[model samples]
Target: MDSLSQPFTFSQRAQKLTGSAIREILKVTARPEIISFAGGLPTPAGFPVEEIHRAFDKVLSEQGRVALQYATTEGYLPLRQWLADQMTAEGDVVSPDEVLLVNGSQQALDMLGKLFIDEGSKVLVESPTYLGALQAFSLYEPSYTSIPTDEQGMLPEYVSSPEAAGARMLYALPNFQNPTGLRLALERRQELVERCAAARIPIIEDDPYGELRYAGERLPSLLSLGRKAGATVVRLGTFSKVLAPGLRLGYIVAPRAIIDKLVQVKQATDLHTSTLTQMAVYEVVRTGFLDKHLPTVRDLYQKQCGYMLDAMQQHFPASAKWTHPEGGMFIWVTLPEHIDATVLLQKAIDKLVAFVPGEPFYAGADVKRNTLRLSFATVPEEKIREGIAILGKLISEA
Candidate 1:
């Protein structure tokens, strides 16, 4: 009965990720007065609540008992077909057989980790990439390597080098990337796909924010370019940004072989995402609500982004450098070299503002203590101005 004799010990992977600084900091940011630019959450105001209710009722009325029941691991056939058609329209040669539905793109990342990443296997990521992706892949214990990126996106020269070939896989957010909101340039996309193909490296192209473009011309997705280059690419997307996040609907487009593996992993993970939710989302897509609804969300975020950028220009110190995103929820800021964003968080929180420090985005070294991510997705235009003003004051004082 001694405490030392207790039989419970967590797995090594769980232990390795137990004290994530981001998760620990999230606890401190929950206060109501704190204007948080840390999380990549969409504003609840834009969720099409009435349409979702209608879609739910229609699905139940139309499908009866089937909507509530369990579904195949491959997902609702019509939704898969619709996604295939969308990809086709986007210039990707996709088929229904190549798609597998998941709870979210987050789950798609996890499933990809489980399917391909062995413990200690080398994986490549953008220098300041999506933190959730870092967290997901970390659970699988991959040896992560940070690839250099600029405002344009990942450096093609580095990605195509033999050093990159040593990695088991590369994860990229080609369109409106998280944290930075940087879009990968079209020429670089073509170069990356062709180079990775030549090096025989598979890419997991996570593109949840592609449809959220507010300005500028659309660039072809890495998946499309990969297809042209005859490469093996797995593309993950979500309805979260477009339709609603609560629906928890996302899908993966990959080779039929990779889809098969991911389906097996998905079956083990959550028994095929919610069939009810999938059906509801499918009905909404069928009704053409998505096509009409998404533009409104885009316009709202665009105005909000513009408001934040304007405020930053007016309020921020001359030394501060920030990315001007064409679309998406985030803006990455680089402060003076003497400033540590993590240390500044305490002061920021005391001033009722919060932002994610840039250090956690890196794989190992603390190269960017001067950096931070600001989100414009959740806050209104007025609040964005207030938040940036607060952040500016803190930075100037620091």
Candidate 2:
């Protein structure tokens, strides 16, 4: 039969998969003149190109064959040890054996889904959560229970609800959460961990933006708090935020049991992450490079966040409200209940400004269409001002 006449069947998983809303929006905003705030991309200016180049050169020069050769699925020993050390230093006692390197935290999420989720399993998440996590977990066809959230983050009291108590897992992005950019309060973190532990629900703490804090004092991670509460917290972290996303390097730290299972899943998936990239990253970060590098990143993000927030204050309608994030790349805006952000995006694009509508960030059908997300990490100060002004005018007119 001709290709056009061919009939094919697709798996239920494949059928359920939907394109990322932000990615779809990005295609329309690709024109240079469009001031796009739709992506969660880190500033290209923050990449340590020279240092990365030097590290890669050193790795090839000293360990050429080893760098190119296929390595263990568990990842390079030195990198895992380094990650374990860093986690331990951060109050979460971890061992190299408990660390599993993945292509990125995105892959970590997928593998975790494979490890834990089954068809129709219940997964608890924040009301307005990271879209990526929802996408990853949805592949396993889990029923989501979105917990009530606020400026301080997830409400611990909700975890006691019957739906939450019986969930297979609780997915959280506690430190500078994606889309919302809200950090969970310290007390809530402790209480959430304790409650989840009592309910026998594991937590997946995706902390890609933890190190990007600019204004507030650093709070203890859920992984660390989970330890005291006897919760099995699987923390996923990435070098993408601090270094370069093109490298696609991230690590997962968990109990030996979980790490062992995830390693098996990864072996079936991509075997292991690139050996050269892992070695190069280890070489670059081994000698306190991130200590110097991160401050610069934090400073840039802080300034950009300040610029966006200030622009919003000057341009936005008094009826609108938005999160003032202390750190991370995004600010969540809640427009008037009558204004749908999806419709606003099309209008904003006509004015050469674009932002992600926030409905897709939510897991349930009961999403607030008035919400949207703004990312400031890559946009210039002038563009931020210009774009927010345009968006403001559009909202006011609406």
Q: Which candidate leads in TM-score?
A: 2
TM-score of candidate 2 to 2 decimals: 0.98
All candidates' TM-scores? 0.96, 0.98
Q: Which residue pairs does candidate 2 place in steric collision?
A: none
Query: Which residue runs does candidate 1 get wrong by more than 4 Å?
Result: 1-7, 19-23
Q: Indicate which candidate wins on lDDT.
A: 2
Query: Model 2 off-target regions past 4 Å?
Result: 1-4
Cα lDDT over the full model 2:
0.93
1-398 per-residue lDDT for model 1 (tens digits): 66469698767776677565666776888877778887788878779999889989988898869988888999999999999998898789799999999989988988888988998898989888888898888898888777899989999788776656678889999888888899999889998998889877899999999988999998888888898898789999999988888788899999999998888888888778788888888888886787898899899889888998999999999999999998889899999999999899989888888888998888756368999988888887778899899999889998
Q: How many backbone collisions does model 1 have?
A: 0
